[model samples]
Target: MMISETLNCGAIVTTSQKGKGDLIPRAKGAAKLLRIPYVERKRLSLANLQANHKNKDILIFSQKGPQLFTGEGKAHEFHLSMAQLRLIAYDRGETDHLVEALGPEAISSFLDCTAGLGSDSLVVAYAKRSCKKMVALEGNPLLAYITNYGLRHFVHENDTVTAALRRIQVCAVRFETFLQRAKDDSFDVVYFDPMFEVPVTESPQFLSLRGHLVESGFTEAILREAKRVAKERVIVKERPFSSIFQTMEPDELLGGKYSRVAYGVYKVKG
Candidate 1:
């Protein structure tokens, strides 16, 4: 698809260019798992799609709101925003702790590899003045549009908290392909916050637009590419009780009422 300018900042991206690096993966058995018709062919955004397409009856939910299902059990509920998570991550000198643990020099040029709604990337941009030249890469086109829209408009105007989002460059591309394009030791820190844990009891406002895309599924390849991209260390966020990262332990513990920030510092002399 071609690019068009929105009222906001840089040109709004909506179309998907079929390429080797494109993230148009057929979500495995999305029909069986998500209980919705899975359109095998990848689409950048369903909003722009022509009316009367396949599975038009089963409308997906919009992802603008804070509601997301975290589990399949009775206790499943919505989680907080990246802003709240960052507050907890920075609380009690943990930002400083993450900086020190990941190495200040290593974090100068950062990349959020699994940039699922571009939330965590915004946090890093706002947390410090030194985090320069940052990119939040999301494979999902609709979420990428949301991320791009919020950065250029809503977030930058209200308060300094969200104002930092504009500083981040939005990349609508697949992670592994980006790694191939990027030079070795290109970024100081590559962060990952994979979609793991239980599905939350989602809200109706959420169910309408976020329908098909929600089942993108967990990606291990993202973690592997994150390790390859970071020159210094890779910091990954995971569920508190049942950790997901199979390799390392968090040298530092950044906690919140619900979630936790677990970081691994891999020293690379670049």
Candidate 2:
């Protein structure tokens, strides 16, 4: 069944896929468009949803356990969920280089040209250490809505998450529109994670239904636009051996257990 039809706007429900329960949900009217597991059973309510966002209560849906926004604030709440499969990368300590490459001191502002689930943006927010603003651009409405909801609920609790979110701005429009809205080289960094073709793994749940529920492909146009809009650098994440994208090569590569962090520290010539 469609996840939205079973949900109510502003109500909190525990989601179930395949008859399993325990994903947190609020009905922000995107249930049909987004495929989030928002249901309207008796156990769901508005106060619970509010509490989930406020960090005053913990919601454990299914087996995902307790995932608080843990971000710095409103601006930083813009993000993607790090599901079990992706958590493998985080567990092996790959996220640290992303934190190091951007750095705590050198960065002050970020524009996520490809803010999928806002995960990359959230991480950037957490690591910015000194950043005051993060403007995220997402092409998917469903993912955008999910990310926006997350920001509103949980980002205000942690000092780092709140601080980063304080500077967060979201454009629910396409990346090209976002690119047109910005001046050339106006930001300290413009990040990209254009979807790459990867072999289907056992972990389909790790992929958001807002994204392709099935394995899928991303476009070259998105990469081209990312280079054009970024002021300081363009970072692309992909599997090490994929070799399909035609974008600029990284000034350096940050090693990961199963992937390579390809990044270009951009510098425009006068």
Model 1 agreement with the true structure over 1-270: per-residue lDDT tens digits = 211122222111212223123222222222233333334324543333323243242222223321222112121112225465555567556644344445544257888766655566766776655777788776644455445555665543336655566677777665666776777778878776655464343434234334334233334555556666777767765555434544444444454455344454444443
lDDT value, candidate 2, whole model: 0.49
- Listed in order, each prediction's TM-score against the native is 0.57, 0.58
Model 1, C-alpha of 226: deviation from truth (Å): 3.0
Candidate 2: where is the Cα deviation over 4 Å?
1-80, 83-95, 103-105, 155-157, 199-205, 208-225, 244-247, 257-270
The C-alpha lDDT values of all candidates are 0.49, 0.49
Off by over 4 Å in 1: 1-51, 56-106, 155-159, 199-211, 214-224, 240-244, 247-261
Clashes (N, CA, C under 3 Å) per candidate: 17, 18
> What TM-score does model 2 achieve against the real structure?
0.58
Q: In candidate 2, what are the lDDT values of residues 1-270, reduced to their tens digit? A: 111212222222233232242233333234433433344434534344445454321112334322222122221123345532343454476566556556344677788766655666777776565767678876544445555556554544446555554455665556666666667666777776656556346434243232321122444565556556665666656655556434544565554556444443433322
RMSD of each: 11.1, 10.4
Give residue 50's error in model 1 in angstroms: 9.8
